[model samples]
Target: MSGERVAVVGVGQTEHRAVRTDVSMVGLIREAAKRALADADMTWTDIDAVVIGKAPDMFEGVVMPELFLADALGAAGKPMLRVHTAGSVGGSTAIVAAGLVQSGVHERVLTVAFEKQSESDAMWALTVPTPFQAPLVAGAGGYFAPIIRAYMQRADAPDDIGMMVAVKDRLNAIRNPYAHLKLPDIDMKTVEESPMLWEPLRYLETCPSSDGACAMVLASERVADAAAKPPAWVQGTAWRSEPTLFARRDQVNPQAGRDCAADVYQQAGITNPRADFDCAEVYVPFSWYEPMWLENLGFAEPGDGWKLTQSGATAFDGDIPWNPSGGVLSSNPIGASGMLRFAEAANQVRGAAGEHQVEGARRALGHAYGGGSQFFAMWVVGADKP
Candidate 1:
């Protein structure tokens, strides 16, 4: 919805792992940035601006991180901005970087997002103490368990639906070299036998605390036209948010997510998301979130998402593949997870995804959500310019 066309000319990510003790926070970011610049066939000096994003400061024990990271990101003399919106920061950051080019403010912008969960007690930091409210004693899993239960009841879904997702994504991770959890032997029995963490969510179904970073180089159409590699054109982008504890808030299917998806689809001329896009990379830190997001993203009717998954509609070989790169369930770097989804979608359209590539993919969708499912960011990218 803009003045100039925007395109993603390069994307890169670090090898995700539970703990990256070898690299400092700055080093983690630089590793990804360097790779992105190389993918773009450019150096740090080619960037006109820089944008970075991360989770709350308490998670890293670092405040105003952008200031300290300015030189590391090649932003010391160039315009640099930091973005934060809970887990959606990565997707939001890329949208902002694209805006700089779309609005004619910059010809090329480099955007990066990262998290080093091993360096800080993320569970403790996420357990914010609110007045008059009981403490979140069990972290993210406990907070979202009730919502998953509600969806199960509302949909009358099979008990094995979550297990199926766990198996599929883990298998997908085996194909992704950079994914953290490469559970090649993962299966339905393995997932069923795993210890339950949040009543319905088993240990095998949850995302690991990872240390990694993801970076992308966005440029104007003029620059993309001359790039060495094929560019993924940005057809549309949108973001939306609402109060976390508002009255009558539908946690199972937040209104902000629905609205945000609609806006992005409208901008991309998507009348039927399920049939329009070749694939999707959605934010699914939990296994069950895949089906939940399928409904919210307009890929399935309400209460029918689980059935779609059960029918193998979302499998890597299926018609509408989701998370061909294994997704957050396999490699979650918190703040960087969102941008990872965006980058993977871009890679799919560019025919750059090696093993998990969708055959003949021409258009794709990338999505992310945060803040108790109240904040949502989505975009559509294509091989051909819009």
Candidate 2:
């Protein structure tokens, strides 16, 4: 939708798990970067620039991580740019890297995002006191529970909707080799019986703490045309942000998310999101957010998002499959989760998603959100050029 066409020619991700004991932080990232380079059939020298991102320093107790990770990613001599936009950093990082090619500033760009939750207590880090703000006593779940309750009250959605999503995504994870959680016996009964962490959010419905990394190689149309594998053509990309707290702010369906989706959809020429995209990989850390985001992203009308999920429209074989890769619920490596969604969307369009591949997928949507649902990023990719 701009100066030059950008396409994702390569994608790679480390095996996600609760704790990646096999590799140190540096090793974890290198593993992903190496895989991405190999997938692209290119060496570090082939890359013109590097872009990387991760969650807050407190999560890893490492300040300015890019500085130490530069050599590990072969970004020492290249123009490496680090991005931070809370949990949306990964998606924002990819968008920025793509921008380098889209603006004709670079022919090839390598982007990576990662997180090692085991390095430090992510929950503790998140609950830390912030000036003029109520503490997140129960971490993310505590903060979002009220918002979710508000959605339930406003939509009058079935209590079983969240349970259905948990079962669906965990079952989907069974097909994803790299996903951290592989609960093959995950069913609604199992989900309902699980311990309730936050009201309406069972242990099964909440995302796990994970350590993982993801990487992608983005190139200009010329470079992508010469690639060995089919590329996922970038149709459009957009991001938006808003203040976390304000008078009567709509946390259930933030305006920033709506605006971001509208912009990307317009650029991608999507008149009806539900019918246009074959699949979607969205940021749904909690099962309830799936339905909430469905409305915010315009995939469903207000107060009707849960109806689609309840009708099985978001299942793996549904009319519009959402998070076929198991998504954040199964393997949430906070920083990497956003890029994982973006990468999975690309994989679907390239027909390289293996078992999770959406048949005949020509177009797909990738979405991510962060910071009380204030920051939003989304992109559309396709098998055909825009």
Candidate 3:
């Protein structure tokens, strides 16, 4: 069935860091929620529903933490839903909230995603053995290392492409006050010389385990029209998933990601993503994924994604800027990482992003993937109503 139009009225996020020891989990969420409520010029009483997401319970060592967080999130007497879709949970959570408004079910919805990595060892939590699969990899880095190596070989990408991305995103983080890493001196030599964690993936190239939260308030078109600030109109949203591992599954470029991008672009009437989108905020937990996702998202042709990076086409001043807010590499709180991308896209369209704002960005893309790159979530947001 066709759905009602939805818009993002407010967005907020915590100051991402290695450890947010000042606040408890409840306090952390409340901080973001309060900020979002204030941005929307509303209060808890205006929210009709709440949706929350995170990577995994094991990462925080707290099973069903949402139960205790209900009161803090203002969901005690309101409809509350929990979501867990690995790394893509944040993006998926926002999608669910948008659906509530689109389906004429909720006039206003508060959606949030967070992770307190200091509470538990994310490496250990991610490496937990599963039945029928040998526990050979140490963490996400180890598992995705081979895939990156394969991409380099298949695409004939230069060895320095990853280093370029690492430098670019970290430098961009300098303009983002809320990002975790602020490497003002980061450069090619620094990235190339850093210790190697996984083959071809250096310490600078990997994402940090961070503690942070992000929240957004979505509203129906009727409510959004009366909001205090400009609303980011939801042009299109799509999600796709596939088994983690199957015969001949192209880990370098997952089919699910391709299909998800295709669906969103089709819905948005985007014939050329590279030209149609002013900028993009994609989930790039690792440096290399920038180019890999560039291809998967149809921004570049196959085996040519790295060329765009090498040519500086993805930089802040480039034709199609990417990750102007520093991105996953700079402040990855796992579950919150994807929502940060979505939120950043909305910020751009609303002209709220301060130093990192793209000039005349009328439309933008937000993308996320999880679980061996099998789960995909994408959306297009614009300043004009759809």
Candidate 4:
């Protein structure tokens, strides 16, 4: 079915860091919102609705924080919605905001996602005991280590692929001023020597707990025509979710993620994602996820995704650049992580991604996932209006 066209008119993000004590949660979100508004050349009154997202409230030790942020986000009398989809909440929130415009419910929508990990321990929060769950799993690293090992064994991948991703992404992070882990001197040797935190996963390979926010202003076709800057027109959006764990679930290359990607690509008329998209911003909190997601997203055949990484095809200057913004590994604000990926894709299509920009980029992809690889969200954006 045809829907009203939507375009991303503005994108903004906070400088991600281990702790953002200078601002309250409201202040942090407001900072990104204000920047997005400024970029859109609009005011609070111009926003018809607001949608916010983040990781679990326990991660920040706040319950229903959006209720307190309504006024700060200029949603005093307007409709405001909240989304929670684990790590994919950021991307899912943006999708909902786009739907507001696509469905003609709103002319303009403001979407924001953030996480203040300093307020609470995310590792502990995730490790909280639950009924019928194994107690042996430590943190995120421990839980995913076995999966990484399984991928390695199945694909016959070398042990150094993860380290290669770590070095490449960390080097790319140096170009992103907002990235949390800017290891300027990071190299393959450095990654190789880093202490192994969970078997196959090293300390340097894991994402950092960060406090940051991301905001975007989406507008309908009529409003987009008046945008001050080029808009990243939404070509397609799709989301999918599956039971976190089941007898037949495949965490390494989740069927839900593949379905989500296929749906979006079909809607966008993309027969070949690696050829159609100029670049991509994918959720890669763990370095190995780059290859894993490549396969799941149809960028490569099963078990062959690592070959692209090995050949540097995913580099910023490669044929199909991936994570030019350094990805979640460089800066992970939990709830905002997925939105950051979506926003970065928009920035690239708009030619606003400065140092990390893909030259002459016209189309890009944004992808995110959560909940033991069950939830998935993705979108295709382009420079021209769809």
| Alpha carbon lDDT of each predicted model | 0.92, 0.94, 0.93, 0.92
Candidate 1 residue runs with Cα over 4 Å from true position: 132-134
The stretch of ten residues in a row with the least summed lDDT in candidate 2 is 134-143
Estimate the TM-score for candidate 1. Answer: 0.98
Model 4 clashing residue pairs (backbone): none
Question: By lDDT, is 1 or 3 better?
Answer: 3
lDDT for 362 (candidate 1): 92
Give the runs in model 4 whose Cα sits over 4 Å from its true position.
Answer: none
- What's model 3's TM-score? 0.99
lDDT string for model 4 (1-386, tens) is 15899999999999999999899998899989999999899999999999999999999899989999999999999999999998889999999999999898999999999999999999888889889877536767887889889999988899888888898888888889889999999888888899989989888998999999999999999999988899999999999999977899998888899999989998898999999999999999898999998899999999899999999999877898889899999999999999999999999999999899999999999999887789999999999876
Q: What tens digits encode model 1's per-residue C-alpha lDDT throughout 154-238?
A: 9889989999999988998888989999988888999999999997999998999999999999999989999999999999999
Among the numbered candidates, top lDDT falls to 2
176-216, model 2: which lDDT tens digit per residue?
99999999988899999999999989999999999999999
Quote the lDDT for 36 in model 3: 90
80-120 per-residue lDDT for model 3 (tens digits)? 99999889989999999999999999999999999999999
TM-score of each: 0.98, 0.99, 0.99, 0.98
Candidate 3 lDDT (Cα, whole model)? Answer: 0.93
Off by over 4 Å in 3: none
